[model samples]
Target: MTNSIIKSLSLPAPEEIEVAIRGQRALATYLSTRLETQKIAIQDADNNTHQIELPTSALTLLMTILGELAAGNAVQIVPVHAELTTQEAANILNVSRPHLVKLLEDGALPFHKTGRHRRVLFADLMKFKDQRDTNSQKAMQELSDLSQEIGLY
Candidate 1:
């Protein structure tokens, strides 16, 4: 995806948050069943009703997007196979571009050079992020345990 599209994912407005709350509730009602596909009827602004079949996976994704919007969070949907610039990857990781470059140089993250610029696979970036988060959580838990053992808590 283009940087413009990524940058455009701002927090939903108050009106949109209300709409997302309602929409998420409505959509979540259909997920109670273990069906492979869901048939949903939606009314348009003109009051015309149309039925559409949505895969369960797509329905779940929509629910997640709506949930984030309802909570006033910005969401960006990136394809797994997409190649992102270093800056874009840094933005996603909430880290500085220089830090990300250092990680790449240290072989902590996998990246490939496209022409003179470095490109990171979205999937690879996610994997690295997940690992980093897991490590952070583990360290936090260890610290908490140590504090408790030392009567610091």
Candidate 2:
């Protein structure tokens, strides 16, 4: 049980670690240290271990997650018109602000400048991504059909 607990805590990704803990009663029970401001400890069914404590790092992450939840994210679940400044648009595209501006100037994304700073609508961004996906799928299908037609598959 100690070996498994150690293995799970040492997992590379926090999500995978949390999943391992939740899936294994023993793993959850092996947690040994946490700060006072950390989350309340939860016990597994048929409790056999009570001396264990959740790690402070894990608890801090959980607290941040709780904060995010409380900050209201359900409203952002659906794509809608979101007026975004240049910096925000850059973040959405995973590009530098200047590069995003260049794309905007090249008519890549439907955007407008408000007194020098540019703004984008979230709906337009979603449509752009959708079109890209559609085109990519169509191209892939064409390639697959060609390969089969040529007896390559």
Candidate 3:
């Protein structure tokens, strides 16, 4: 099944950033141990309290989100197994949609056809991106070494 569409999130306000900073600090304190699960007590605006057990992994993810919010960044979570549209994949790579399509046609990236639409697995796309980034870094390093050898760097 197709995953839900990605939604744009607005930047956090000053007050929200402050709250996120506090929340991230509070959450970080609980992550010092190697516990599989943690029991947390939460209070609502109406003064109602609830206790819930959450996986440590989930808590760490929450802490990361809070840290991003504290830094005034907007964040979105995508499942690794989700299928992404060409446009969405392009957005993630900061590339144009036509370039993404060309890459797909050239076999630089893997995709499957759903009827007539092409869908890229998020995991495959990420793997391709990581490789591309590594290649770029290697090329830059080579260029820098060449420049240094020529006494121009």
Per-candidate local distance difference test: 0.89, 0.60, 0.91
TM-score of 2: 0.44
The TM-score of predicted model 3 comes to: 0.93
Model 1 per-residue lDDT tens digits across residues 11-113 = 7899999999999998887684588898889899999999999888888999999999999998888889888889898988999999999999999999999
Task: Tell me the lDDT of model 1 at 128.
Answer: 93
In order of appearance, the predictions have TM-scores of: 0.90, 0.44, 0.93
Candidate maximizing TM-score? 3
Name the runs in model 2 displaced over 4 angstroms: 1-79, 94-99
- lDDT tens readout by residue for model 2, 1-153: 111111222213555445444544443454335444333445579774445455576655554443444443211232365577767667666779998888789998898766776778778877877887899999999999999999999
**Model 3, stretches more than 4 Å misplaced?**
1-4
Count of backbone collisions within predicted model 2:
1
Q: Candidate 1: TM-score?
A: 0.90
